[model samples]
Target: MTYTGEVTVGGPPDTREAGDLQITKIAVGPMANNAYLLRCALTGEQVLIDAADEAPRLLELIGDGGLARVVTTHRHGDHWQALSAVVEATGAETVAGEDDADELPVPVDVRVRTGARVRVGSCELEVIEIVGHTPGSIVLAYDDPDGITHLFTGDSLFPGGVGRTWSPDDFIRLVNDVETKIFDRFDDDTWFYPGHGDDSTLGAERASVPDWRARGW
Candidate 1:
């Protein structure tokens, strides 16, 4: 089946193969948080993004391969609900944005900033920090050798607009950062996986940038 980037709490995850990497997305928790499991095809090394919930289910997906690291996109409770459990089970190193690292349940082993790189076997994911939804919410970009770029956006971005912000200034900051750092740098074919709900391409949502900005959300 094709990777639709759509999942529900009780359904099987959707996966896509990109070059040497395999990307699996599953939904968990009552909030319906999306958790991504990235596996390197070359070395079988795996890295998980957001241990949102359902530790047993996540572990089942991991199987016997074991996990190397778990990257929390933000400090939100829903995003890290199973962080402690998952890390304890796999002994995987914890990674999070520098500003939000201390807020997580586990001690973050890697506090990354923009431009930092996280490796999974021979594959690498570039980090891009977007502030507004949280002080240090981040998005990970993977430049697939055989395909287009793929982004794992936390609560910082969604299909229709940026993440929820408490203030007008925050909304503006998020929009500007998303536009300059993400939209400007990536192509229209870039596929983005959000923290919740479904995924979308930059081209599909490009024209709505002005509308999202105008609404100030």
Candidate 2:
């Protein structure tokens, strides 16, 4: 689905705020990848996730520069298509999963591992590595002060199921990791933002976990 262009072309058309954190979503590139802008309301420190495509548009969203960093969730080319452009334009520090760092076009200033945290002002997002999609796929989880949890799941968990896997073994590993690291950890209210398409709640997707595993996709 093509985004309204309200967000992808210029600024955020739909922005969600909770406690001290704010999230804005934009769909860009041929794959309709979802790029996110996460901001700390109190400190105004912001971080961009995915950088997907359309360098000029992504740079515009970053503006003059309150951007603290840019974190690529995985190594897929589409996910980092605009990485170099954004880095050159804003000089923001780049971060990526340690396992996928070498696959990225630009060098990653910080290598992230499971349990590492990325701070956005007063709030923080904890990284949880979920392998299988690309071996370095990760999901960022932030627990809000208001009792809500927000997750930025790269290509790991999607609206309906886990990310596409090449084989049965890959599918099993992805599903198991997601169940152990994610499903067992968070509650129903946790909101997850995927690499493509709309957001979903952990509660909304819990029932399908069994079905997803059985299908082995």
Q: What is the lDDT of candidate 2?
A: 0.87
Maximum-TM-score candidate = 1
lDDT of 1 by residue, 31-99 (tens): 999999999999999999999999999999998999999999999999999999999999999999999
Looking at candidate 2, the ten consecutive residues that score lowest on lDDT are 2-11
Q: Which regions of candidate 2 are displaced past 4 Å?
A: 1-12
TM-score of each: 0.99, 0.93
Q: RMSD of model 1, in Å?
A: 0.6
lDDT of 2 at 53: 93
Candidate models: Cα lDDT each: 0.94, 0.87
